[model samples]
Target: MTSPQAAPLANAGPALHAPLLASAQIVFAQVSINFGAALAKGLFVSLAPEQVAALRSGIAALLLLALVRPWRRRAAFSRRDIGWCALYGLALGGMNLMMYAAFERIAIGIACAIEICGPLAVVLLTTRRPRDFAWLALAIGGLVLLMPWPGRAHASDPVGIALALGAAACWALYIMLGRRAARVGAPNAVAIGMVAACLVTVPAGLARGLPALDAPVLALAATVAVLSSALPYVLEMRAMGQLPSRVVGLISSAGPATAALIGFVVLGEALGPWQWLAIAVLVTASAGCSLGTAPPVSKLREEPLT
Candidate 1:
């Protein structure tokens, strides 16, 4: 008789659950970030991009500090840990600054699409499968079509594209440092890194007269902090620890479409029919990924903040 273990189970344990949950985590992160972007655009008319970055970063740092209370467990991390967190924070700050700068000069979806080039490069370099290449090509094709190229006679601002590229570089560094920081475990690592980020941003805001502190602006900034800075960092960090960077990067390719939809809704930034078709291709590409088999079971064991 065959051993019980020898039999193939129709559905077994967390085999079905873990990847689905991981995919959901990624999708939720994309949604939260773009909604936050929409809110940010409303404030751009009142505040400069750098000023907005300072506000969002500072508020997010404060919120994360309160929730994590990293002060209580300060002794857990080594000097090396501290260094990694510092660098991680710096990368995040740079990314924020670059993205906001790009946003001021470009459309939301376009800036987001350009910023994604960083992570997409990381994924392409690390991946070996031809299938992964096909997926990446499809997603990228959609993005290229969506972007209003210079040759199309409506040249996008070169400075804006440059800033987006800078943000992409920062994002690549952020992802690398983020993975290292994740090993330092939850709240302590994230909280400390955010503090470092605050150092970069808060000072800039003070120099700019701290517009985010005004009564009317403060509320919106707080919401932006929650949805964009706080939620995405926390959620993405969690998922990064569980999934391979390439897999996470591939899944995040849906970001442009998500941003486009949010921009269309909140800012009335309408997309042409071709843009809609591009969005559909992005969706199809992200869906076609092997999400179920990408992250192994070992990844599911999260290290608590404690």
Candidate 2:
């Protein structure tokens, strides 16, 4: 799930008890997201990728609004706050749109691996430590290996690859804006921001599915909304509250690999050895960055955004 307000925590201690249960919660968040991606891939056949992304964002906005009730804080938000939310929403919309476009033509694992370059760039820019350069370089090299070439001519669509990279850029901006939003607003900013996201994406035919009414597709889209957005947000917040930040980073770093595995198991998309190795390398880079000495620039206090 996307971090609603900002980045993951900067400090967390190792678990003291019930490690299995705690780890399971974070792992479930990862699996649920990837599996939801797989489901979204199937929906792309009937609905345009834009349409699917729109429905997911639109429905998620409504659900989050109902759950969060942003109006309760109506007097709390200022013009500057609304502007930040709009920017955050624009980034969110672009990220999801580009991601879905990429997902339409690429394997889930490949798309996810490419999209992760966004966060990697964010970490790199935030860090000043020279030693982490090695990890960053390894990540870049891993991405190179993942490119479609030589024996992997059919690994991914060229256009999809481009879109994934764009999604990466949007995701980097999303992180920065999210941090700003967290400062002036609470997690309810997620609800407010999603409204702007809906404003941006809905015009791209978000309601197209409404007239064509099919039980299965409607059900599937709803399920995607809950699994990809609602459920993971809840699970991640809980895990973040209980577990150490380092542990969360390490476990969440498995995201790319988990996506690949889920793609293979659910969609029958298998990659070559180099592709898997690429996934491994990128994942390692992410884990290393999470443990980097670049102190978190985010000044937001670690408190529930309720």
Candidate 3:
């Protein structure tokens, strides 16, 4: 004998949990990605950044294609949808390539802080609420703090900063285009997108003359493919389908802090006090943005991979 009041509350249960679940998924994806990036940096010792990017994209594309077999659902996508996926993949390829190149010159954490500017730009352009602006300001302040001053000791390389900014632009495109592609379906969009990414990345890597196909390098590259691309991209696609672009961008503000921590733990990289403060500020902004009531489930768009 459920009362009227109880029935409405019961109906609201799943809706209340959806955003939380999506947030968790995004956070997990970030952890997986940054950790993978740290490991991929190790490969730079043996292979060029382009080669590493190529290996990751190539392996990830094959794994995703096999798993999703997007061809089976080829009829579900239109030419426009395929175009969106290709654009998304291009952004993905560029983002990975530039970020890896940046890693060659700067610490992973610092590079991530710079690269995050891309998604932050998306948030600034898309969000209109006053409170959201506050969070954006906080995030921007953190980024400002992260910039290398002219006379600062241990200053980041100028080329690295430029490359990170390039990655940031690609990341912005990845967010917007990924959402558009996810409309058709996540798994299908991502598989086709990975193929497109390989086109952009693989040829350049192979140009380096088949980088040391030894077992250790191959195994690490495959591990990076799984952790960095295959797993995180799928999780991100599904999460993006369930959340607004602004919310997703804001949630990603946690990336620098996560990357910093993982960089410290895995690569023995260290950050100065001011740099740590910047990460803290970015994390604070992310926390503020995520603390409110979740958006209604009706606002969510769920498209099955089928």
lDDT by residue (1-306, candidate 2, tens digit) is 547443334222233455657779888988888888899888877888888888888788888888888888878878898888888888888888888888888888887887777777777677677766887798889878877785675466788889989988887888778887765555566777788877767777554554354988888988888888778777777667666666676777788799899999988988878888888888888777766643353211121111
Worst 10 residues of 1 by lDDT: 297-306
Candidate 1 regions with alpha-carbon error over 4 angstroms? 1-26, 128-155, 206-212, 232-251, 273-306
Winning candidate number (lDDT): 3
Model 2 misses residue 282 by how many Å? 0.7
Q: How far is candidate 1 from the true structure (C-alpha RMSD, Å)?
A: 5.6
Cα lDDT tens digits for candidate 1, 1-306: 666775555345566677667778877888898989888878998998888888888788889989888777768878898889899888878888888888887667767766665654555555677876786788788667656665554445778878977987887777677677866775677788878877777677678685635788989989998998678767777677566644664566678778888888888877566656766776555444434224532122121110
TM-score of each: 0.76, 0.87, 0.81
Q: After superposition, which runs of candidate 3 have C-alpha atoms over 4 Å from their true positions?
A: 1-26, 129-134, 234-251, 286-306
Q: Least accurate stretch of 10 residues (summed lDDT) in model 3?
A: 297-306
Model 1 lDDT on a 0 to 1 scale: 0.71
Candidate 2 residue-wise lDDT at 237 = 72
How many residue pairs clash per model? 0, 0, 0
Tens-digit per-residue lDDT, 247-277, candidate 3: 7655666777888899999998888887888
TM-score-wise, the better of 1 and 2 is 2
lDDT of 1 at 289: 43
